[model samples]
Target: MVKSKPVMHKAGHLFSFVLGVIFVIGGFLATYLKGLPLIEQGKASKNWPTTKGVVLKSKVASHRSSNSNSSTYSAEITYRYQVEGQNYKCGTVWFGSDVSTSNRSLAQDTVKKYPVDKQVVVYYDPQKPAAAVLEPGVFKTTYFYYVFGWLFMGPGILMTGIPLFRWLVRVGRGTDERGENVAGKF
Candidate 1:
């Protein structure tokens, strides 16, 4: 009787799973660690300020859906200011709302709180005026990305690692079911 070799499907799965895990972990770490630094850099840059400004313009726009169940809103603002001995016009877009009613309400509230042509303080990067952000508390929009990234990453690592660990343990028992020795199972 001819014997078919045991394909290492699990091994491939493990590799892909581990890769996903690494991506999640790395993303979380990058977000967490870099958040503060980015904030600080915004503060230190000459171009950016945390002071009040008269909003030149404000409008609501839509962005690509983050998911099938949700939609997103973008609040664009144009503030006039001068940098490096030249007149400049800066505009920033704040994301608000999702498909959820609660998120939509939150976005509406933010809009109401900070209306068009209203005076407000915005945090912006000096190098890029287009890359500006509002102070965190003004809108109360939850840092969803940070939350989502960490949430998946923690479990992804475990989901990928545990199986690989179990496979290692099985291989360590010195049984070969695939013609290759146990030591070469991985």
Candidate 2:
């Protein structure tokens, strides 16, 4: 009787290792890109030019969704400032570039900080003078992206580590190259 040599396939292990590495890198990349804007805002807050601006309007704009009776509020503020003898008006208070919010109190609090006719320190981009903001800071919501990134990366690391640990420990007693135990097979 002739015995056939068992084929040792490593495709499954290779696939898992490759996918795990991709997931880890992809999660880190997504998180890093999401944080770049916040970082830029931080740097802008410190370096952007400061000028005097007068609040033309300040109120919490309310919106009601058609699907439900629930309403949302957003801080709608407008301010005017002069840069190099040119008049400019802008509505951005921070770099978030959006004002829609489900929380009314938070929006109201933001509105209260810049009451109508109140004078505020405006930060303006030197190259694009029209772009301006009353407040220079990162949004609280950005932290969620960081948390999610770590969440995704954690599982990816585990997926990669398990196989790697198995390989490193040389726990391949009677196991095929696929990293599966074959001792109980026959």
Candidate 3:
């Protein structure tokens, strides 16, 4: 009887390896490109010089998602401050940009925190006086992107490592071109 040669399949393993590598790269990019900068800005803002500012207008802005029935809410707070005699108006509450929450009360609470005409401490960048924030330094939200990036990295590591481990095991098994076990053969 003639024996049919075994077919060795490495495509699946190669695919896994490629996918894993892509995930790892994506995770790193997310962390470094998006998360790290926000964190750094948050930390730096803590020491920025402060000035007196007044909330000109504070309101809740609603954003409806195009692809879904859901909506998000954020506090639209506009304030005015003076730096080196130049008057500037800014809407930034912090360095991470306006935070949107699904809960309306959250945005409402933010608006309440800075009601119209209320005076607040404004932290301004020395070099660029136009850049300023009401609440400086790192807050719980500051870690959002940083944590998200790491979340991707964890799965990426698993995806990458598993394929690599399997490839190593297969190589160690010493399979012939026909994928037959050749470990004990000459």
Candidate 4:
């Protein structure tokens, strides 16, 4: 009984690892591409000038309890505006340190800053006017996500591709030699 060498097993592992990495990269790219554009489009659409809106409601929702003493809050805001001669009401929950005066003041300040029935500008997508947000500045933060995404993605693809290429070269050479061996045996 001849024992098969472990090269074939390693080759399979290399192939799987490369494919898995590509799958992850594809997923990230898809998400990043889809998300980045929406952010940009939303920001650009804001340049069209905000339509005046009447604040319908404003409240703070506790997102998480931190250290049992402090908690994170999300600002829930709703407003009514007219789009294409029709009235519409849209609301969104905005979170993050930038949404507030200070990190510690996230929920409280947000709720207080924009009070109910306050007249303010609302930014909405012209194509889908129903999808709107009270805080349009959220798009600015997308720059960081874009930077970090490329940073990790570039290296990940390189690391995965190099090993797979080497494995393919080895497999090709092995198959060529094996075929010669069989021809000689016959």
Candidate 5:
């Protein structure tokens, strides 16, 4: 049983190290793959062509959590615009606008800003006119995923780095003060 304890300890460390690596990868993917694109798109949207559009539907949508007694709110604003004689309907207010928040006031404020039938400027991608948004440019939410990535990466670096650093130190020393080989111990 005593022997098994050391083996189990090593196994646990190995698992944690692997998990940390996964976190690092996941964080990078989240930042670059998911977040960077949104930010870039949002930035590009600022230069997109604009057209007159009317709000067809604007309201706050509430969603309840499945696992807990909690709810989130999101602004569900639908607007329609015409580009080069082609009409397009979209619900995007801004980039990453689909994300819901625990703050109901934010959603409510959005709904109040764009009531139904209100005339608004819609920005559309010239390459794909069907893609559009009411508000352009990167907002605070644009950095959400990018910052989220660092959350995972920070811990991952510590987990993977600490063990590797210890191993390096052991390798450099080769033996402890008592002349006991410590290189095998990481």
Candidate 6:
């Protein structure tokens, strides 16, 4: 039983380290994904080449949830553009990319800006010509990613830092002439 206690103690420390690493990685990944929209938009504005595209299709798709009997709507916009005699079809119509909402009117309003056959400007990534967006801004969802990222990261740092800090405190206190653990005497 005594031996098992030490094993359990070691297991606890290992668990804390592994859990902290997982949370930190997830936090960073979420933050990175949140920033992708802004990065793509910024890149498009500065150096991405643009071409005229014809709106092949534009509509609001309302997807109903069977569980809650609720619906979420998204503006579905598909356009085709040609670059250097090569044609490409892109479905990314908004800066936020397929901006969706629970409010049907919001989706409908977005679709109006790009009716079928309407001519509009399309921005394409120079390196990957197929990647494009009609809009170049982020949505409210972007902030959610950032918020969740920090929520995970805060505890992650605490989990990792607290152990290291406690170890340092113990090591520092051990140098005292008493040669006794402070908490142990108490």
TM-score of each: 0.54, 0.56, 0.73, 0.60, 0.82, 0.68
Question: How accurate locally is residue 136 in candidate 1, as Cα lDDT from 0 to 100?
Answer: 33
Local accuracy of candidate 6 as per-residue lDDT tens digits, 1-186: 256876888789989978998888888776677655454464455457789999999989988878877888988889999888899999886555454568898778878989999998988887778887776545564355667777887888888888777777777876332356665554
- TM-score rank order: 5, 3, 6, 4, 2, 1
lDDT of 1 by residue, 1-186 (tens): 634434467566767787777876776774576443443443454345554456676655555555666566655556665445554566543322222332445445656666767866665556665455554322222344444556667777777777667678667876554435556546
Residues 4-101 of candidate 3: C-alpha lDDT, one tens digit per residue? 43322466556766877888888888788978887888899989999999999999999998998999998899999999899999998976557577
Sequence-dependent TM-score of model 4: 0.60
Task: Give the Cα-based TM-score of candidate 1 against the true structure.
Answer: 0.54
Candidate 4 per-residue lDDT, tens place, 4-73, comes to 6777766776676777687558646744874466456555654545688898888876655455666555
Model 2 over residues 45-155: C-alpha lDDT tens digits? 757899999999888888999999888788889999999999999998876534476888888888889899998899988988898877776666535455666777788
Ranking by lDDT: 5, 3, 2, 6, 4, 1
Off by over 4 Å in 5: 1-3, 165-186
The Cα local distance difference test for each model comes to 0.55, 0.77, 0.84, 0.63, 0.90, 0.76
What tens-digit string does per-residue lDDT give for candidate 5 at 1-186? 256876888888899899999999999998899899889989999999899999999989999988979899999999999999988899989988888889999999999999999999999999999989899999998788889998998999898999788777766879653457976588
Which scores greater on lDDT, model 3 or model 4?
3
TM-score of 5: 0.82
Model 2's alpha-carbon lDDT is 0.77
Better of 3 and 4 by TM-score: 3
- Backbone collision tally, model 3: 0
Q: Looking at model 3, which ten-residue stretch has the lowest summed lDDT?
A: 2-11
Q: Which 10-residue window of candidate 2 scores lowest in summed lDDT?
A: 2-11
Q: Model 6: which residue pairs collide?
A: 95-135
